[model samples]
Target: MLKDSFGRVATDLRVSLTDRCNLRCSYCMPPEGLQWLPKPELLTADEIMRLVTIGVERLGITEVRYTGGEPLLRRELVEIVQRTAALTPRPQVSLTTNGIGLERLAAPLAEAGLDRVNVSLDTLDRDVFIRLAHRDRLADVLSGLEAAHRAGLAPVKVNTVLMRGVNDHEAAALLRYGMKHGYQQRFIEQMPLDAQHGWKREDMVTADEILAMLGKEFDLTPADPRERGSAPAELFLVDGGPYRVGVIGSVTRPFCGACDRVRLTADGQIRNCLFAREESDLRTALRSGASDEELAERWKAAVRGKRPGHGIDDPTFLQPSRPMSAIGG
Candidate 1:
């Protein structure tokens, strides 16, 4: 098992397949998006598979999450999932997508051994969705979620980033929509990961505020906590309801101590934390024909120095140099 200095075992690996996204989310990337990494620089499917194999075989990683500026935009995504699923222990495979492209790809991805999906859907209001995502694809996203559910991706999850005075007003409505469609909604507090570096503490909707907003419409109870796991969301049951909602208070109530995940950008840089200021370049080493053992050692070195916490509440906290799109959500 790969245990960091803080004793947090690394079990989850988030791989960003591409830095190009169709939508320019206000809280994620700049309006102009970004100059994406050249295709030649992006890690190939074989390289990604090799890294996943090493993580699973050597580092005790058991969960492989495919992320991106939008993972669905990656052409080889299903192939990546298929290969990762074929590993010895067969790590649980999942994806986080914007859902605009999911309607066409969900069934194929599910058939390729994807375990589940977390779709980004911040609002059902067309105007709000357009204003936030810089796209008018709310209906497309909704259809994609339904497609994923129909394809047997059980318990499809929705990731809603709540920005104060923006989409926070839709808290109850979003929850109700998820509940109605049998989707588990997870409200995430906007962090300092925006491309513009414009995150303000007062603009973030905290977990407490999210609960309070939902309390206006439903009776919620703390759900029985699952086994201590790497997944970040904290779950809660809607009183008298069949489904539950989750809250990832990344900023206000950071879960740094229990973090067991590491990240790999599309360009093959290993980031120990979402807010990590530094990253180890894995692409150069991989292209240099480094042996699997050597690659595994590189991963270990990165984890050994993982920061204890994100320091979101610290007065001296600084936003990451790269935006969420480049770092992978």
Candidate 2:
């Protein structure tokens, strides 16, 4: 196991295949998106597989998650999942997507060996969805969730970002909808990953607020925190309901101490933390004919230098140079 200076073992690797996305969420990016990485600058499917192999075999990464501006946007996604699943001690594979293109790709991805899927659905109302995502594709997202469920992606999770006055009112409804469809619902507190850097604590909804809202609708019992493993979400069971809901309090309640994640940006930068001001460029080394062992060493060095936490509450904390989409949320 690769243990960082803080004694946190690196076990989860999030590979961002591309910095391109189909939707432009107001909080994530501008309505007219920012300049994207040129196609030539992005990592190829083969290169991603090689990195995954090194992370799995050499670095002992046990879980591999494909993230992106939207992961499904990658044409070679299924192939990537297939190759990841074929590893010796095959790491559990999953994806985090916007659900826009998932209707067509969900089944194919499951067939290709993806173990699970997490769809980002902030609201069920068509107008609200459109206003938030800058797209009128609520029906498509609904279909995608259903497709993922039909494809045997059990406990398909829904990631809902709660913006104070925005869609925070939909908390109970979203949880109920997920419960009805057998999706594990996770309410995420909005973070400072917005491209606009307009995140305000006053406008952000918190995990405590979400739980208080849910309390009015259903009974909730705190679950064993140990079951959370390396997941960022804090788990809780809906009192009498069949499923549970989780809250990722990245801002108000930071989980940085237990973070075991290392991200590979689409442009090939290795980020030790999402909010880290600096990144190590692995693309340059890779193109220079660096061996797999050398690449692994770089990865290890990056993790070894992982900071103790993402200082969201610190007065001097600065938003990252890149947005969530570019950094692979």
Candidate 3:
């Protein structure tokens, strides 16, 4: 098991397929975009599978989420999911994507054994979408969401980042839309992960603010806390019934104590924490003919050094050098 000194065992692995994204979301990157990782630097499909196999079989990884600047842009995504699903004691496989091309790939991805998907959609209005994403593909994203639903991706999650003076006013409407479409709406507090390093604490919409906005339109009671487990989102029963919404207060609530996730960069570096400044180089070890056991030990060592928390509230807090795009969501 990948146990850290803090007694947190990592069972969820987030792997970055690429650092290249189609949409230039204002929160994520500049319109010109940062330089993407070179093709040779990216782990091949076989390499990703090998690392995942080691993680699942040796390191107790029960869930694997493929992330990227936009994972839908990966050419081998379907094959990767299919192979991951074939593993012995198969781990749950999912993807975090921008939903750009999902309209065409949803059925194929479902058939390829993708268990679920989390699509990043900040606004329902096309003008706002363009302003946020710098793309005029709102219709495509909506179509992708519908396609995923039709393809049987149950509980299709919609991740919304509430930026003050941006799309924050749409919180209620976004939740209402999710409820109507059967999508699980997750409102996330904007963190210090933008490429431009432009995230301001004052500009972020807090979890409390999000709840207040939603509460005006719907009755929200806390969902069973026990059911939350190691999940980042704190769920709430919408209108006191079957449907629920989630709030990921990463900066405010900080669930690091129960965090079970570790990340692998597109180039195969192990990130014990999202805000970690250092990384363990698994790619070098793998390329140098290190055995699986050696690789696993490297991963374990990395996790053992994880800090107790992200420490964003501390005066000494420093934003990670890599943005959310490079570090995989």
Best by lDDT: 3
Order of all candidates by TM-score, from best down to worst?
3, 2, 1
Q: How does candidate 2 fare on TM-score? A: 0.98
Best by TM-score: 3
| Segments of candidate 1 deviating more than 4 angstroms | 240-242
Q: Write model 3 residue lDDT over 1-329, tens digit each, in one string.
A: 99999899999999999999999999889999899988999999999999999999999999999999898898999999999999978999999988999999999999999999999999998999989888899999999999999999887999999888889999999998999999999999998998899989988899999999999989999999998999999999998879989999999999999999999999999998889988999999999999999999999999899899999999999999999999997
Where does candidate 3 stray beyond 4 Å?
Answer: none
Point out the higher-scoring one by lDDT: 1 or 3. Answer: 3
Query: In candidate 3, residue 159 scores what lDDT?
Result: 98
Q: Sort by lDDT, best first: what order?
A: 3, 2, 1
Candidate 1 lDDT over 45-123, as tens digits, reads 8898888899998889999999998998888888899989889998999999999889899999999999999999899
| Clashing residue pairs for model 2 | none
lDDT of 3: 0.93
Candidate 1's clash total is: 0
Candidate 3 deviation (Cα RMSD): 0.7
**lDDT score for residue 14 of model 1:** 91
True-vs-predicted CA distance for residue 63, candidate 1, Å: 0.6
